[model samples]
Target: MRMFDVCIIGGGPAGLKAAIAAGSQGLSVVLMDDADHLGGQLVKQTHMFFGSEQQRAGARGVNIAKELVEQVTSLVNVEVVLCTTALGLYDDLVLTYETEGSYRKLSAKKFIVATGASERMLTFPGNDLPGVYGAGAVQTLMNVYGVKPGNRVLMVGAGNIGLIVSYQLLQAGVEVIAIVEGGPSIGGYLVHASKVRRAGVPILTSHTIKEAVGVNCVEGAIVCELDSQWQPKSGTEQRIDADVICLAVGLSPLTDILWQAECEMVFVPELGGNVAYRDSTMCTSKPHIYVAGDVAGVEEASSAMVEGELAGLCAAKSLGVSGAHLTLQITSARSQLEELRSGPVGDKIRAGLLQAHR
Candidate 1:
């Protein structure tokens, strides 16, 4: 078994920041990610982020990922392990993982779980067809691999992912037919929604995809209006011609390791789904275990980075690394988080955190 002062189970924005904080404090850190590379979803995002300048507002996510990765790699105290999947977290502070068809174990004085969220799939007829893709899948297909998902696309959900992808599809020279949302109003930032709308893609509120019309793959989609109860209104179904149906409904926290560790979990709808209960410091019920990013709650990457810094600072502090700089950094991180979650746009996330915090 390998031993380290800290083990971070993700390499996304959160995990990367966590490793930087802990490693900068002179702690031996191991940052492991299931993917072959670090940066997580940040590498797939092509749009500029929204936040204060301190959070790198106006910077593209891919650029941010590059900067963070550079910082992490330069830290000699931090080890980067890729293509490693954490299987379980034991009570003895040992984590089991699989890499290259072999099982391995590692123990750390403190652990930070930054495993992000998975895209939620919508249940509809023919949703299992070949052309059906998740929002993340679409981003990866276009932004990462530079492949057009299809010529014409029917986007499901009007959230940030849906709106952003719709615009991305247009930029990729694909035709987006329309964006359908079950809610009465758009769910994403107005700026994103306006961009797609300006591209001549209609956003249908109080509407949903009833089915994906196809034999072996998506040939079209059946969309309809929804009533106050969110039930589909009869006679409102309309067929849309498209080869791809992208689902961007929502995301649920990936907390399997937290569950295995026996950390207290709660289902907060606003936060997406079941998430580990954590304090402001991002520490879970288990003293030595911490969570950040979507695993703690589904929020933007900006907040995830702050939460990651907080978790790493607290974890290092718990491990006897202390100084005025560390204290100031922790305080700044907490304040940044609060500022990020203080607006009308953060209402849902603020409510979710209320129910998720210990």
Candidate 2:
């Protein structure tokens, strides 16, 4: 088994940044991602990011992923492994992964689990139908594979993912029948909702899918208005024609490995789901184990990257790695993360973080 100073799992923005940070400190680092590509959900994000200049604001997510991959690959001390899956966490910080039909084991002094999050699926009639797809799946199909998800679609969430994917569908020449949200108010940014609305897609608040009507696949959908208690009201059901039913209900962190490793976990619905409990430095309950990105909690990719930088720098510093600017780098990263998590948009996240601290 080859030993490394840091083994970063899931080569998305967080893992890639962590590898670069640790490697820059002259630490031996190994970065692994399951996909043939390095970026997690970043590859499918075609929209410009929102943040300050340091967060690569205005840059497309695809471009940011490309830049991060290039930076990590150029670092001599970091080994990049694509098409690799980190299967399990074992005693002594050992990780096992499968690649090229062979299982490999490696041990590291520290680990950064940035496994990201999985899209939540809605339970409803005909949900498992062929034409029913997760919002992220639709994005991957259209953005990454260049394949149209469907010609006519009904979006079943008003969150950021649903709104953005609806707009992207329109850009792809797909017709969006309507966006149905269970909440009284739209969950995503008003700007995004406005963009979709200007394009003629109706944003129906306090509405939800009664059923994805179909036999072999989704051929249409039945939506109904919700009462104050969130139950579908009687006599308000409307049927619409749509070939695709895209569900963007929410997401949950991918923290099974953290559970296997016995890291302290907390359930934060705002952060998506159960995530590893980490301190300000992003260190989890396990001293040598750290977490960032969606695995820490389902925040944006920019914040995930900043969190990765904090973890990587702190991990290096904890290992007695000396650098004149180490302290400053860590401070700046933490500040940037705080700034990103500020504003009314981050109120839930702030509440979640506070709950975790408690």
Candidate 3:
């Protein structure tokens, strides 16, 4: 196994930031990702990011990832490994991984996992059809591969993923027939919902998909109003003329490695499924191992990047590094992260953190 001062798993925004931060500190760093390219979900994202100027607000995720990668490469201390899937975390902070057709291993004095999150799945009658897909799948098909998921779409779920994907479907020149929300109102930001509505899309609140109606590929969808208990309301059943049904129920943290690393966890639904417990410094129960990004919990990419920076600083400090540079970096990063945990949407996140700290 090769050894490095720092090794980051997951090459998305968080992992990329971690590798850059560590490398800038004179540490030899490696960023490993399962995808053939860097930028995790960012590459599939074609929308502008929302955040403060310091957070690169209004900039596209693809542009941000490209710029970050370029800067990190110039540092010379960072090596990026693509098409690398982390097998598991072994004893003594050793990590097993796969790249191309070969197996590899690496040991890190300090490790950061920013593997990110995966889309949540929901099962319904006939949902196994080829045209039924996750919101991320729709995004991947349209934005990355330049392929349309379908011409007419029925979006399930009212959260950010659902709303955002609905809008992206329109952007891809597809017709979004309706967005069915199982809850009373939209589960995501009002701004995103408003954007969808302004584009002539109807958001059917307190509604759900009864089944995806198709034989081989998706041909249509069955939707109905739901009561408080989620039971279908009689006389309200309707069929949406659609070729694809995109499910955007939510996201779940991809935490297989964290679990293999033996980190303590809690099932926090708001933070996105099962997550590893971390301290203020983002260090998990296991020493020398850190968790950040969606692998820690599901949040915006901006939040993921901030946590990645903090994790890098904390990991560096844990390795007995002392300098004004690290102090300044961490202090600034913490303050920025604190701001992101404020605001209306952020209040729930902040409350979760308070509970976690407790």
Specify the highest-TM-score model's number.
1
Q: TM-score for every candidate vs. truth?
A: 0.99, 0.98, 0.97
- The sequence of per-residue lDDT tens digits that candidate 1 reaches over residues 1-358 is 8899999999999999999999999999999999999999999878999999988999999999999999999999999999999999987989999999999999998999999999998898899999999999999999989999999999999989899989999999999999999999999999999999988999999999999999988999999999999999999999999999999999999988899899999999999899988887788899889999988888999999988989999999999988899999999999999999999989999999999898
Better of 1 and 3 by lDDT: 1
Give the per-residue lDDT digits (tens) of candidate 3, residues 201-282. 9999999999888788888988999999989999998888889899999888999888888888888776877888889888
Show the lowest summed lDDT stretch of 10 residues, model 3. Answer: 349-358
**TM match of model 1 to true structure:** 0.99
Off by over 4 Å in 2: none
Weakest 10 consecutive residues of candidate 1 by summed lDDT = 276-285
Query: Compared with the true structure, what per-residue lDDT tens digits does model 2 show for residues 286-350?
Result: 88889988888888888988888888998898789866799899989988988998999888888
lDDT of 3: 0.86
Better of 2 and 3 by TM-score: 2
Judged by lDDT, which candidate is best?
1
What lDDT does each candidate get? 0.94, 0.90, 0.86
Q: Stretches of candidate 1 above 4 Å error?
A: none
Sorted by lDDT, highest first, which candidate order results? 1, 2, 3
